[model samples]
Target: MRNYLTLFLLLFTLQLSAQNHVFVETESFEDKGGWVIDQQSFVVMGSSYLMAHGMGRAVKDASTTIKFTKKGKYHIWVRTKDWAPFPKGPGKFQVSIDGNPLKQVFGESGSDEWKWYDAGEVDIKTETIKLSMKDLTGFNGRCDAILFTDVPKFTPPNKLEELSAFRKKLLNLPDSPVAAGHFDMVIVGGGVAGTCAAVSASRMGLRVALIQDRPVLGGNNSSEIRVHLMGDVDKNYYPKLGRIVREMDNGDPGNGNPDAKEYGDARKTSIVKAEKNISLFLNTYVYKVEKQNDIITAVVGRDIITNKETRFEGSFFADCTGDGTIGYLAGAEFRMGRESKAETGESLAADKADNFTLGTSNLWASLPRDTVTTFPETPWALQFSDEYHIDNTKADWEWETGFGNFNTITDAEKIRDHNLRAIYGNWSYLKNHKSQKYAKQELAWVAYIGGKRESRRIIGDHILNQMDIQEGKQYPDGSVTATWTIDLHFPDAKNSKYFEGQEFFAGTKHIKVAPYTIPYRCLYSKNIQNLFVAGRNISTTHVAFGSTRVMRTCGMMGEVVGFAAYLTTKYKTTPRGVYQDHLPELMSILKGETIEAQP
Candidate 1:
């Protein structure tokens, strides 16, 4: 008979069916950093995941031998808030079970704290066996916990269950039911771009619906895996985008999770809901697109809380799925991954254009301050020259990428990890080992925002090209704008023959023209006439996307798409017509609005 604890865990998991199976540590284990006993699902060490150091590993990468029994149909789920720290620049983690190394099962050895996933299935040849984990330096690793349960026996009711009354109402909709539901606009994705898109478009006299996959509004910036919002808007050198950009950045606490009133852009769940025009749909993903000819008639969004599908038809739709989901589902033409130089004439393109694009991140962040020294100094402590790595503690973050290949998953997960790794790796370089070590400032804050760069590029009327960007091209029908500089990623930063590595040091290269106008032609579907697209997936050549893919730009583009949709509904005219003959009217509406939001 299974223990009562197991029974309780099963029942409790069924109750909170949507969440990851959580197994708290009843007994404190210091050998594993006590696991923090956090109340919040992802609350690392009961304070902030970025406290003292950015990531939490297997305490100090201690050797752990676990024996597994109870074989039939048992799948092990390892939910870790884990990161593989680098020895010098980037390191790998090694695990072995049943004589097969975990790298074989997990595909790669590196990850950015991807949690609540299958560590791999355990096939029991023998009743008992040992699973071992050791970092590249044989010292540092981040492990939250491993949960083993009978996959088949752990099933909840066959029928989907509903959580809230709102979800119950949505669940009853038929497959193609046309909802009388009227939303001013439905904005998908809640990243920096989506957040700004919802706020901006709503300010233009419309009820807004914001749908996100995660519970939090700030996809990357939420407490899930800390990443501070950084870009030209950090007031680095660009100052014009200051107000709207700074609106998100409430300031930094220089400490643990500060109050919303304190510092840091508190884009947490509650804060996002306060906007009246913005109806926050947390944990809802658009799984289906209802189409009428070329236009997206409605979006069938899945409310994860109740497992119900609700169709939301709006005046206009914005495809900010980051993966170009809405347009793709609606059969709007789209492109995936990097195009060869021959394909787009992009300078950084490879011989053959591959769809190995970047995707979402699973991240981790920490505050390794100068105050306490309890943070472990592992045998894998990175020793580096002034260039590759810096040598101090405060700013020295040992996060970088080594595992996962770009061939599979189109490098989506890898891109996410690399971007996150860069955050920590860049911090370490600034903190300790460098010519500018003396100039290093205290690592003020690590971001909850995971910076993901590339994804699906939705096909549109015109693909923005690098040469056009170089020449500062403008269109008469231009509705959106791109102020950021053009910064392209290299084909291979690591010089791999088959796989292109990441660009080590890259930035917004100043364009010949700043704040260049983006044409309305580029906003709508080339193939699907009524469909609209936005975000990093807009019609842009590979090189041009490098500049326009930033979240702020995506937000601006989303707003424009919404506006075009609004015009189409109000004047009963095609979006192209508004640009061709009625330009004065469109400009009038866009110019008159000041963003005053209410909940």
Candidate 2:
């Protein structure tokens, strides 16, 4: 009887200890090696994942050390997707435990949806073990998170809601967000417009918080995207409006320049750091908003790498995210597509209201090498023949996708993947089929970050239309002269012939227009009381957006918004109240006049 009691107690203790499991997020790895953290699909996928973007060659392995509570046999599961499901995906990789590679390969499954792939069972001999991801074919292989469980028949949740809850329970995240301090104004983007707004408001004696999701400052003009600044600055109604813009402009390096120095990422970062009143937060993505009645009180942002959430409280807020993400989260009225001529009464408006917006661009360039270089055949990529292929060494703005059929925000990942297919397939044809013609040229750079043009436009008190540009309409609150031609893009006829709905090339018609000052009424939300908007997401019809969406013009609009924020702080009023009550005070500031000495 004594031996039976002792055995029963030993069995109970072993059962309790066997319930140990460890969850590891790939983005939090100390050394990421060649894998890059991609947050573009986080809104849909629930979290950021690591992608191995090596064009076609295998990249360096990503390794990390994990400490386990109980050492024994455990089931390994990895969250990943095949990405391109045709026979099998090109993105193939393996997992290694303590330098021992697993037998089952990942990212070659039949389904394209993101799900957990069982990586078989392994015996963990020690409390601490080294785990690594080895890329077999580096065509954008990705991994979200890894799980090690000792419990039999244990599986992680697949649905987003359940997975989120499970992550919080396992990772021990706080229920309430950690406070990130209160500010006079909180700007939610780090593009040229948001940067200008932060600097301008900080100089005018207002505490500002500038939040950017990416590492760099310039949005499209950043080194990662490599788009040049367009439209004329300092040539507008208010000359002082674009002085900040001029300071950040790094002379046109063209659209798809391979040189990183030409875009000047460090230059923009230094400028924002110099301002004492501005607090800049980089690599932080805002996902939640707190509102009181009609005004936004605070926003909650999560660090992309650390997964730590921080709440930013502010008196006023700005929506400078190019996709109008902040305004959309606040339930602000917004439009996503073109307005019919019958509705807007503009000649350039579409005959029928439809879901047609400008497409996104993923640019690429090739450099001339001294010796002949070879590229592998991409059978999984979009196939092209000699009869229908873009016979070019480099791609520019013309290489675009997701025009009339696709949603720019929801279908962003698919659109980017389609562009990649087109790029690789076209280059393959040129290299293999027409090698004699282009033997010396090698693919130098291809932008994994897509340069987006149009998305949700937050409605303001005034919506600028094409007639405003054509007639040169001037308003009392007019500021920021837009000089770019009214440009709209459509699918290229030749490429559409081969790939109808998935056309990658774009064709545009540029209509000349006189420089016109955009109204300040178009920069603030009509319904959302304290929200100010700038960048490409400001209040503009699809027709007028063609002219007002340029970088320099968007920067000037930001400058005006900063000045308006100053007035809001001084008078203790909303954004709409500034235009209705204190128009003169706003104009005086735009004219470069100080308001009763700087605070």
Reference-based lDDT, each prediction: 0.50, 0.88
Once fitted onto the true fold, the runs of candidate 1 whose alpha carbons sit more than 4 angstroms away are: 1-54, 57-184, 219-275, 302-310, 340-342, 345-352, 355-388, 392-449, 491-512, 573-577, 580-582, 593-599
TM-score to native of every candidate shown? 0.59, 0.96
Q: How does residue 256 of candidate 2 score in lDDT?
A: 83
- Candidate 1 lands at a TM-score of 0.59
Cα-based RMSD of the predictions, in order?
11.1, 5.7
Q: How far out, in Å, is residue 546 in model 1? A: 2.3
Report the C-alpha lDDT of model 1 over 409-437, residue by residue, as the tens digit: 23343443454455454444444434243
Q: Give the range where candidate 1 is weakest over 10 consecutive residues by summed lDDT.
A: 43-52
**lDDT of model 2 at position 390:** 84
lDDT of 2 by residue, 1-599 (tens): 66764574456346445577788888888778888888877677667888888877788999999998778899999999988887677889899998899998899896788899898899999989999998888688889999998879878878775676566555657988889899999999899889888888888888999999888899889987888999997567776789999889989999888888899899999999999899999989998889987899999998888888889999999999899988999989999999999999999899999999999988888988999988888887899997888888888899999877788887888888888888988888899999887788888778888889999999999999999999999999988889999998889898888898888899989999998989999999888899999999999999999999999999998889989999999999988999999999899888877676246
**Candidate 2 runs further than 4 Å off:** 1-18, 596-598
